[model samples]
Each structure stands twice: as structure tokens, then as C-alpha cells.
Target chain A: MTEKKTLKRFASVFLASSLIVGALAGCSSSEEGTTTTTSGGSSSGSSDSSEVIKIGANLELSGAVASYGSSIGKGAELAVEEINAAGGIDGKQIELVKVDNKSENSEATNAAIKLATQDKVTAMIAPATSGNVIATAQIANQYKIPTVTASGTAPNVTENEDGSINDYVFRTCFIDPFQGIVAANFATELGAKNVAIYADNSSDYAKGLAASFKQQIEANGGKVVAEEAYVAKDVDFKSTLTNLKSKNPEFIFIPGYYEEVGLIVKQARELGIDVPLMGADGWDSPTLVELAGKDALNNTFITNHYSSQDPEETIQGFVKAFEGKFNESPNAFHALGYDTVYFIADAIKRAGSTDGEAIQKALAETTDLSLITGTFSVDEKHNPVKSATVLEYVDGNQKFNSKVNP
Target chain B: MEWLQQLVNGISLGSIYALIALGYTMVYGIIKLINFAHGDVFMLGAFIGFYAIARWDIGFIPALIISMLLCAIIGVIIERVAYKRLRNATRIAALITAIGVSLLIEYTVIFFRGASPEAYPEVMANKSISIFGASISSQSIMILAVTIVLMILLQFIVHKTKIGKAMRAVSHDADAARLMGINVDNTISATFAIGSALAGAAGVIFGIYYTRIDPLMGVLPGLKAFVAAVLGGIGSIPGAMVGGLVLGVVETIVSAIGYSLWRDAAAFVILILILILKPSGIFGKNAREKV
Candidate 1:
């Protein structure tokens, strides 16, 4: 009887724990100081000389883009380490209240809100995907907190229908239009007259790149043989490939991340299609070479923020420091991270205070800031106006090919 | 031209699904429990193949065999550890346990491989030959050929061998088969091992053809193969093949004809319509519960 009762109790406890974990998985931000308190009272800032500036870093730390996010986080951490080592920023140490969003939008949005309201973080560097950026930007704006995204490249991340950008949000990376134009011009320069496109229909970034690439290709007198669309999670591409081959294009342009790009390149090659391939910054991972093999990517080209082979002092310094720290060369996304922190630091120094309005004003007026990405200047609408680099893989390493000023 | 193109795409994909469904059907034949983990076993097979290439720089043929052997071992282990102990449990209990085992394998993959999909190396991907205005790659031809050979080998084994009789007997009635001096447990394990090996083969082809592999890669295909198994008649071997091919072809045709978004939805819609109207699939025997 005792054993039966004990077994029943154990089952109930296990069931409760599973339910709690499920709920946590669904709304993970609550554990990160996001509480369910009603919005009647707000706390006032205390006048402490050694004040703590809690900031949130929500990212996809364990998914397909983990390497990108992990490197970005390391870059950000490097900034924090440098700042703190130099006796902190404004005599207040910056504490990163980090949360792994794990690529789930609901959890990301929840984390952003939690960081803003419950943790009452002074600022945030958010949920990295373009969709996550758009979603979290609204919450940050609603709560009146300053948030800057490092690498959400979709135009809608900043721009509104009326050619205005969101006031509260800023991004370090160039918009998709810039990347698309750069890719298109690069393709034209390569003398490719016929091209096929495979795009991720779900992501705003992929759709934007496809539209822009197609428009530019047509504008440049290049024929689009076929356009195929795929969802983010679908790994199989036999049908898409077969359908695409019916048109018989000379080159293929995939404007998604490295995950599908690597697979597409490999499968496309296996099918005896040895056409050159082109992509955007999302293909700048070392894993791409490892996954797709160097030979497969021999003729591939892409437009990126900065390459590991960049000879610029800041970039070389960043590469060395990053390698010394993490033991691997940082990619374009990681460069965005290093630039994001520096950009924010520049704004803080200009603002001379952590006041949100002052920081926003300083950020809007950013100009001639030498970043690892390149020289960045914030436009009137607060988008980064900077030249990007064209990179190609040679002998298994991404090398700087040329700079495009689109 | 478009319709013809759609048909070609569908037939090609359907063949791949048919290969995977055979694994699901054969395992369920003996144990009556869906090997939910079978799809992951296929994924494991692909990874094993990848490892062979990465670590050993092995040629395609050797990589293929090593990958199949790895999957077989994984299947046998799953049987010994999870399914064997649950044989006496209620059917629903076994089904749920299978699901748990499947999730465990998937998450374990995520934990190690991370969430990002890895691209298959290009030795197989970047080659194509145009035939009849349809582009077919050497990889596709290889996938089709391997699947055909596997089907023939399976047919031969199931119809011509003593173990085949043991499998049939156990699947038909475990108690009667035991009375007739057949080792029911061993037959069931052998069935799972073979079924898992086929899944492994399909998985390697899937990874090569898709050019990407992730932890949760198996769920949709696994579910689809299960649906195929039922569509062909739950316990029928050839029926699973037919069902998988039909499902694959229909999905491909749907996408090729420009309803790309609705392509996946079409598979389930057809499965549901078929089940509601004709519970006994095209090749399935009408199952009657013994009172």
C-alpha cells in the first residue's frame, strides 16, 4: 500500500515538473526576470555612484545559426571585457543579462519584454532574425527602452511604408537591398547572363533578396530561367532541383543562410550541375566549407560586411583578437557584433549619459565611425550607410575579393 | 510540358518515399508497433556516411555500406533496450514509448549537432544529366537504383528464406508461432534490424539529395512513411512501396504545378480522404479483430 502511494506521488510530481518545463520552454523569458506584474507602478532610478547597467542579449545560441550567434556574443563579450578592464563605462559596469532565445520567436519576444520590464534593463541587443527583430522592436518601443540589433538585414527592420524608419530601433548591418544589389552587380560582373533563384519564402530576408536579385538581374539584361521557393526547415530539394533543371540556367543564386545553401550546393553538384553559385552574407561560415566541401564552393561568390582575409588594421586586429580569444576567425555576423558594441559605445560617449533620448539622438547622428565592418555612417533614417565587401572562397578560406559601394 | 515536368518530379520523389516506407512497414509487420525512431535511424545512417567521408575520405560505395551497417546496429540496440521490455505493455503504451524514444534521439542529435542544418558535402550534389528534357543527376539515378535493388532483395528474403517464414508466423500470431518452436523475439529483432537498414539507405539518399541534414529531419518523413505504410495496408510490404511512391509523386506534382505551399498539405489530405473512404488501403488486407 505504501509502495503504491509512493508510486502515485512520484508520478504526480514528475507530471508537474514536465508541465513546468513545457511552460518554461514555451515562455522562457519569465525565468530571466520577466514577471507577470500589473502595469500600475514603475521604479525610479537610484543615485548610486557604482550603478549597474543591466542589458539583455537575446540570440539564437543553439540552432542552425548558432555559430553565427555564438561568435556575435563573443564579440560583444570582448567589448564588455575591454570596457570593464578599462575601469568600466561611466564608472558603472555593464552586466549582460543574457538569454538563449533558441530561434523561437515567441520565446524571443517574451524575453525582450521580460528584459525590458521585469529586469528593467537599461538597453537590449535583441533576437537576431529579421522577423524576431521586427517583433521585438515593437515591444522595446512600447516599453520605451533603447534596443539596437547587430545583424537583422531586412529593410523592414528600419524602414516603414512612408520611407521612414522605426524611431526606437537601429541596426548595424546594411539592409537587404544593399546586399541584393551588391550580389546582382557581382553576378553581372561575372558575365552570368542566365540565373536561377532558390529562396526561403518564410524569411523576410530571403524573400527580399530574391525580389531584389530578380529585379536587378532583369534590369541588367540577365534572364531569370526559373525561381524556386523553399521553407526554412525543409532539407530535401530533389523536387525543387529537378524543377529548376528543366529551365537549365547557367548559375544558381540562393539568398538564405548557410544551412540550406550548403545542402543545395552539395545536392546541385551531385546532380552534375557545376554552375557557379552566389549568395549573400549568410553564407560566410567556415562550416559551409566543411559541410559543402571546398571544391563544391570553389566558384561560389558572396557579398558580405567584412572578410577574414581583410587587410584593414581594425579588421586584422579584430581577426587576431577574435582568433586569440575564440581560436577561430570571426565571420560577418561577428563583425556586426563588434561593430554594434562599438557603435553603441560611441553613442554613449557622445550622449554622455544613459538617458534613452540622448542616446537615440547620438546614435542617429553617427558618422565616420571606423568599425571592423568598415566606416559606418548613420543615415537620416538611422540605417547604416556603408560599403560592403565581395568575398570568394579560395582553397577553403573566405578571401576578400573586392569592395562594392552600392 | 509543365504537366509532364510535374509528373517526372513526382515519380522521382515518390520513389525515395517508397524506399523509406518499406522500412516502416516491415518493422510494424512483426511487432505491430510503429518504429517512430526509424526515421532518425535513417538520419543516423546519413551521418555515418558523412563521417566516413569526413574521417576516412572513403569513396561513395564504402561510405554507403558502412552507413547501412551503423543504422542496423542502432536499430538492434533500440529493440534490445526500449521495445523489448515494452512487449507486454498495452499497445497504446508501446506507441507512446516509441514516440518518447524518437524524441530522445532527435533532441540528443540537437544537443550534439546543434539546431542548424548541416550541408551534405558536394561530391554527390553538383552533377546533373539532362534526359528527356528533364534533368536527372547521377545521385538521383543512384538513389533510384539502390531503392530498386533493396526492394528486390527484400522481396527475395521475405518470400524465399526460413527467417521470412518465421517473420510471417510471428507477425500472424506470436503465441501460435511460439508453439510451433519459432523464436518470436529473435525474429522480431531481425525484422527491426533489416527495416532499420533500409531506413538507413533511404536516409543517406535523402541527405545527399537534399544537401542538408538536421536533428528533426526525420519527423516529417517518418510520419509520411507511416502514412504510406497505412495507405498501402499497414502490414503489407509491397503496398508500403506503392503508397510511398504515390505520396511522393503527388507532393512533387503539387509543388511543380505551382501550388508549392500546399504541396505538403496535399499528402495529408489524400491520406485522410483515403482512410475515411477506404480503410483498407490499396494493398492492405482488411484487419479483423479476433474476438
Candidate 2:
């Protein structure tokens, strides 16, 4: 009877400790949520009487694509710092409220809701990835906040599949179809008659880019020798590479992210299949070089947004400032981040008020706004009509090859 | 030539699966419990090998040794702490505990090192030697040789040694063996140590061959290895090796024939077919239960 009582007491104590832990976790997360709300509310509450404008930055600060998120966040923060240092936009200091999406689509939607309903941001800068932007764009539209994505390049990101424009969704990056056309044209320029595509079937970004490239390549009188697909998170590609090698295409296009691309390149080279590799913007991470080995990347090319090696003064200035602040050279995503913040601020300034409707109008009417990458206008679909830069890997360095204009 | 190339590819992949499957078969041979956390130990082994090479600048052989020793110790500790208490409990309870321990290790590793995949630094020069117009890398040859040597060593230990006799005796009837002056717990710990050591060696080899490692790298391969164990009658040593090789060859052939998406599905299909045709597996003897 005594032992039974002790067992019951132990069970109760265990339950109590777990409940305490659960409560503590809940409290900490709620404290973070409320801090953002209170801070945003206090700043914007005085916006009508004062010179402060609140903007929300929903980014993937820590997750699968955290490198892209953190780089883009740093770029946006740098732009904000520059704008404030120049005595603010129209004498109104821009207050940037940053929220991490944790690199998940569900978390991104939650971030949009929190920023819109609780923080009451007049406008928002969505996450860099296309999938995350699509996830949160509905929330932005529902909340009636003007939102801009710096690097969401999927075609459907700004336009619905039903041929209707998403007014609240805007991007500073070129769509995947344009990038794919650029790649096909570039492959033709290289005098490649036949090409192979090893696309990541699991990613919408990779599949869209591959489809576009294939269509354009055939239109430009080039034959797609073989097409193979692999799901995301697969490291082994020997069987697929071996099958593709039998076709013996002149160039292999892998429209996948750095993680899989790196392994694919390494395995392909190991199989003694030594043809130049090409990819889309997904191959623009530092981790690629470390994984694929510098020697393996010597004959590779990727279509990118901005090359840091650009001799243009505007690009140079941004690169220098970014390197100074981050202690590392900025990639294409960083440039998009910097350009995105300035783009949003430009709209806010042109709108002449912090009202969401006014900002949305100004964003739609943005024209020839010069920033990093190139000077272009936002079209009716809300995507930038900018040039795509083709970057070549020469002796382990990414050099600027050529720029293709839309 | 294409068939030859596919065969080489299959063998290279199959050897790694065999190395991991050996651990599962040996542990199940002794203890009735399936050690589900064994695969995570393989992942940990790879990380240990990676750190030994990247941080300490240790050579490949020394790194392999370090990973093997550490994982063996970890295997013994896991058995002592998690499995020992639940030894006499219901089979379902022990199985649940094994799964719980698997998640605990996977999440703890993820908590420390984020979920990003890391590149295994190239420690050896990768050179391929062509045989009958099929290029085979030196890495594949090394992996196959190591796997063969380890299997032979394991067979010798299990068949020839006095400890091997004690293990077999304890596996047959633990309480009876204990009554006849045998240490059942020590024999079981020795089995785990040897099995985990083989898994560690397999992990290091896999890292070298694939050139990438991540926290969750072991999940699919682990499941495949489990299937291999089951296909090879679960507790038989040679059966695990044959089953692994066959699974690897079938997967490679499927992918080579333009069914890359069905590679994983092909493994399970073979498993189901084998279970239906020969329930005792390829090398397993059909023994009637004395209930």
C-alpha cells in the first residue's frame, strides 16, 4: 500500500515537471510575439504625429536556406542603415521589424499574419525563396499590405496560374522562365548542339526552370539528348549519371540547389564524364565549392542575378559596402536583398503616406528605379524587367560572362 | 559494358549496406530486441570520423579506428542504459523504447549541429581504373576490400573463438547458459560492441564514397539495411550480406533502366516477394516453435 502511494506520487511529480516545462516554452514564444506587437504598435501609433514609418521584414533567418536568408537580411539591413543615415526617406525614419520564418512554409504564413494583424506594418518584405513568398502572399493580400519579395523568382510568385496578377505580391528578381530562356540562349552561343537536363523533380523551382530551358532550347534548334529526374535530398547520382553519360550530350544542365548539385557534379566527374555543367541561380551558394571541390567547378556556369565582379560603379559600391559590413563578399541574393529594401522604401516615399492602399499604388507604378543588378521597371505582373547575368567559373572564381536582357 | 558498370555500382553500394546489415543481424541473433538506434550510431560514427580528419588532421585509417572504438563504446552504453532495464519487459515495450531512443539521438544531434548537409573533405586522391570499358574508382575498390576483410574477420570470430561459443550458447538459451556458468550480459555486450564497430567502419567508408554527410543521412539507408536484414532471415550473418548485395544490384538495375524514381520502391518490392516465397529467407532454416 505504501509502495503504491509512492508510485502515484512519482507519476504526479513527473506530470507536474512536464507541465511546467510546457508552460515555460509557451511563455517564452508568446513573450517574443508580444514584444514585436508592442514595439510595432508603439512606433506606428505615433507615425501620424511623428516621422516614423514601420515596415515588416519576414525572412528565413535560420533553416534549410538560412544562408540565403541571413545574407539577404544583412543586405536589407544595410539598405535600411544607408537610408536612415541619409536623413531618412522624406524626413521620415523607416522602422524595420524583422521576423524569422524558420525556413518553413507554415511558419512563413504565421509570420505574415503576426506582422500584418499584430505588428500592423504598413508594408512587408517577404522571404527570399519562391515557395515561402507564395505561402505568405495570400496573407499579405488578405491583410491588404503591400509586400515585395527581393528574390522570389518563380513565375507564379507574382501571378496566379489562372493568369491573374496578385496585386499585393511584387518581386525585385526576374522570373524562372526568363532565367531559363537566358540559359538556353547562352548554351546556343556556346555552340552546343545537344544538351542533357538533370532536374530536381521535387522542387517547383527546378522543374519550372528545366521546362522553360527545354522549350527554349528546342525552339533555338538544339536537341535535348536526355532528361533525367531525381528527388530532393538524394545524394547518390551515379546510376542516373551513368545512364546520362551513355547519351554523351555536350553540356548537362542541373537546375537544382547547391546541396544536391555539389554531389551530382562530384559523382559525374568521378564517372569520367567530363562535360561542362550548367545550372540556374540555385547554384549560387558558397557551400557548393566546398562540396563539389574547386577543381570540379572549373568548367561550370550558372545564370545569376548580379556578379560581384561587375565593373559598374553602382554594383561596385554595393559590393564594397556589403564586404565592409559582412566581412565576406555578397552573392546575388544579397544584391536582391539590398535592392528590395530600397525598392520598398522608394514606393513608400512616392506614396507620400503610410497608408497601405497608397503604398500598393506606388509599388505598382514603380518605373526605371535604379538599384543593384540593373535599372528596370516593375511590369503589370509585379516582376522586375531586369537583365540576367550569366556567371562562368574560371579557375575556381565566378567571373562575369555576359548579361541577357528581357 | 553498361551491365558491367551497373554491376560495379551495385557492388559498391551493396557493400556499405552489407556492413550496416551485419550489425542488425548480430544484435538480433543474441538479443530478441531490434536495436533501432543502430543506424543513428552509424551516423554518429561518420561525424566522429569527419571531425577526426577535419579537426585533428588524422589519417583515414586512424580516423576509422577512432570512429569504430567510440561507436563500440557508445553501443555498449546504449544497451546498458536503455535496453538492459527493458530486457525482461514485453517485446512491444522494448521496441517502443528502441524507437524512442532513435528519435532522441537524431534530434539531439540536430539540436547541436543544424540540419544542413556538410561536405566530407577529400582526404584521398580519387582515381578511377577502367575495367572492360567501365571506369571504377579507387574508393569503390577500397570499400569493397574493407568490407570483405571485415566480414572474414567477423566469421572467424563468430565460428572459431571461445567467446563465439559462449555467444551461441547464450543466444540459444540465456537462462540455461547462465546456469551452466556463462556470463550472458557480457556476451551480449560483446556482440553489440563488435556489431557497432562494423557499422562505424561502414559509416566512414560511406562518407568517403558519397562525399557528403548530414544528421539524417542514416534514416533511409538504415531502413534499407533493416529490410536487408529481414530479407536475409533477420538473424543469419551470411544471409544479411547476400540480401544487401542483391538489394543494391536490383536498385541499380532499376535506376539504370530509367526507373530512378522507383529505386526505393524496388527494394521493398523485392522484400515483399522474398517474404512471400521464402519466409525463412535465403539461408535461414525453418525451425518449428516449441510452444
- Largest lDDT belongs to which candidate? 2
Off by over 4 Å in 2: A1-50
Model 2 Cα lDDT, one tens digit per residue, B21-140? 999988987887788988987887788788778877888889999989978887886777677767899989988877877776676666555556778888888899999989999999
Residue pairs with backbone atoms closer than 3 Å in model 2 (clashes)? none
Candidate 1 Cα errors over 4 Å, as ranges: A1-66, A77-124, A131-145, A159-165, A191-194, A218-225, A272-274, A324-326, A352-354, B1-15, B48-91, B111-113, B116-137, B173-179, B208-211, B286-291
Cα lDDT tens digits for candidate 1, B1-291: 445545655666777788778888888888888888778777777777666665677777778887777677778767776678679989898888788778777665554444555566645444566766555566667777888899999999998999998998999999999999999989988888888888888877776766677667888888888788888887899999899888988788777665676777888887798789887789878778789
**How do all models score by TM-score?**
0.80, 0.92
Provide fnat values for all models in the order shown.
0.29, 0.46
lDDT of candidate 1 at residue A379, scale 0 to 100: 87
For each of the candidates, give the backbone clash count: 25, 0
Model 1 C-alpha RMSD vs. true structure (Å) is: 6.9
TM-score of chain A of 1: 0.80
Relative to the true structure, candidate 2 reaches a TM of 0.92
- Candidate 2: interface RMSD in Å? 8.7
